[model samples]
Target: FQISLPSLKERVQDIPVLAKHFVAVFADKTNKAALEITDDYLAALKQYTWPGNIRELKNIIERSVILEEAGKLTTDTLPFEITHTQETGNLSSFDLALVEKQHIKKVLNYTKGNKTETARLLNIGLTTLYRKLEE
Candidate 1:
């Protein structure tokens, strides 16, 4: 019996459910308190292309569960690749400036407006972050 499943990107509606399930599994495996999945986190998962599919999702959730000390799964726990993928919706054209601005803003939000952390997450020096913010 040959069975085939569609890629995660083709099953957007399933993202939230699978993510929540993985969160539960990982939380249990890590022996952590019950973790709540934020709507924004689910939204971010849905937005990602998920090239690595279920295995990738599982790994991400496990990492988030282990790193999250607050008992809540949030976008801040997600990797830069997944989080940054949300900036551009249309793949046909790329707007470097707009995407960069949006990415900076998102990273800033993730860091709770902590410029130093944001700069670190963005891989930019503090001065560079300030310059880009000013632009």
Candidate 2:
């Protein structure tokens, strides 16, 4: 007979239980009991969109444990970008043309559409700015 292990997302509710188990295991291995995971910490863990699943969660927990001093785990222990996106729900982008366009617009407005000043403010050559603007 064979049994298959459950995927982390399917077992999301088990995070707290697993965390406690990890605490015990790590404490015993390291001969330390200074770390305690708080309810808020667990809630954040539950809220996170774990794209990389259990392995990612375990790595994060280990990192937090190593960094934390004796006390309850705090939101600070979690990665900043994760927390930021979770809280603010901002759109992430990688469109270079869009970014350049936005920057050019802002600099142009700030300089009252003065091409020379906009170029200076943008730290780019005037010809480059003109080329970008043409596009």
Candidate 3:
């Protein structure tokens, strides 16, 4: 007798658990700081269409874990498509420049208009920051 399991899209709530599990499994192997997935990250996962199902989600989580800094996982650690899932409706609907602009402004607000701090927080160069803001 075989039991059927749900796809990642069919089990949205499981994202956080699986992501955490993967983080623990990989962080130790890579000797990196343990990653903490933010609420926004989990929400984004739920909103995404899992065409590749759990494998895709797992790969994304692994990438975030590898790229994690100071132990916190921000939406910035994720791909623009995943981070902008809410705005674009689907991957094919992405507007990267618009997304970058909004993210830059949001970060700028967070850093109280400090371009240097905003650039550092966004993991971008100062020139890149200036260029994006100009767009």
Candidate 4:
């Protein structure tokens, strides 16, 4: 009988078990018995949205195991976007636009709102920057 498992995002709660299984399989294949996952690491995995699901998780684990010097996995070992998502949740397009506006405002502030300098720093034309601010 062929039983197809659901995607990882559809079964995010299974990450820990899957991670453990992968670790065991990898450890056996590499003849490295000292490797083990930490609770913190698993928690981070659970918190992630896993847009790419199990395949992405598997690739990340494999990459981490291959590159990690120690047997332990830390949140730092995960990709930056994962951490960003965990901290900020998923940002909407409006949120992104706000961030960009804030950044432009900061740069302008630093230049004392000098359009020419702000545009130069931002690598945009003064007229374009003005138009953007108006929008």
Quote each prediction's TM-score. Answer: 0.68, 0.56, 0.72, 0.57
Error of 1 at 106 (Å): 9.5
lDDT of 1 at 108: 90
Off by over 4 Å in 2: 1-6, 90-135
Report residue 58 deviation for candidate 2 (angstroms).
1.0
Model 2 lDDT, full chain set? 0.72
Candidate 1: which pairs clash?
A: none
For candidate 1, the TM-score is 0.68
Q: Number of the top candidate by TM-score?
A: 3
* Models ranked on lDDT: 1, 3, 4, 2
Q: Please identify which of the two predictions, 1 or 3, would achieve the higher TM-score against the true structure.
A: 3
Candidate 3 clash figure, as a count: 0
After superposition, the stretches of candidate 1 with alpha carbons farther than 4 Å from their true spots are 89-135
For all candidates in order, the CA lDDT equals 0.84, 0.72, 0.82, 0.73
Candidate 1 lDDT, 1-135, residue by residue in tens: 999999999999998889888988888888887899998889889888988999999999998998786879888788766776645454545577766876898779768899999999889999999998888
Worst 10 residues of 2 by lDDT: 82-91
Two-way lDDT contest, 1 vs 4, winner: 1
Which residue pairs show collisions in model 3?
A: none
After superposing candidate 3, which stretches have Cα over 4 Å from the reference? 99-135
